[model samples]
Target: MIVLLLGILVLAIGGCVCVVWADRGGPRWVRAVAAVTLAAGELLRIARRNRRRSIKRSSGGDE
Candidate 1:
């Protein structure tokens, strides 16, 4: 669980760095890769968070 969260965070920070680097006139390929990585990382994080939320909501009603 913690590992996943850390991986996601690391990817996210790396993604942002790529974007900044690309915006400053880095190679086209760099920019493309950064965008792709950023999107993938965000999607994974969102999915994980959403799954946790659903679990919490479902389990709490019994309390």
Candidate 2:
């Protein structure tokens, strides 16, 4: 389990590096990886926001 978490952390860091490198005119593969990482991050952000909204509604927080 620990190994899996460490692997994920490494991948996340690598993806971030790719994003920065792409911004600085890196190779095609780096740009592609950065794009994917950015899109995935956006999707996750949206999903989390929607989940929070749903939870708030269920708890009657609109009052």
Quick one: best lDDT, which candidate?
2
User: Each model's TM-score, in the order given?
Assistant: 0.57, 0.94
What are the Cα lDDT values of the candidates?
0.86, 0.97
Q: What C-alpha lDDT, on a 0 to 100 scale, does residue 62 get in candidate 1?
A: 61
How do the residues 1-63 of candidate 1 rate in per-residue lDDT, one tens digit apiece?
999999989977877888889889889887997889778878989999999889989899464
Model 1 scores what on Cα lDDT? 0.86
What's the C-alpha lDDT at position 12 in model 2?
A: 93
Considering only N, C-alpha and C atoms within 3 Å, which residue pairs clash in candidate 1?
A: none
Q: Model 2, residue 58: displacement in angstroms?
A: 0.9
Candidate 1 regions exceeding 4 Å error are 1-17, 61-63
Native-vs-model 2 lDDT? Answer: 0.97
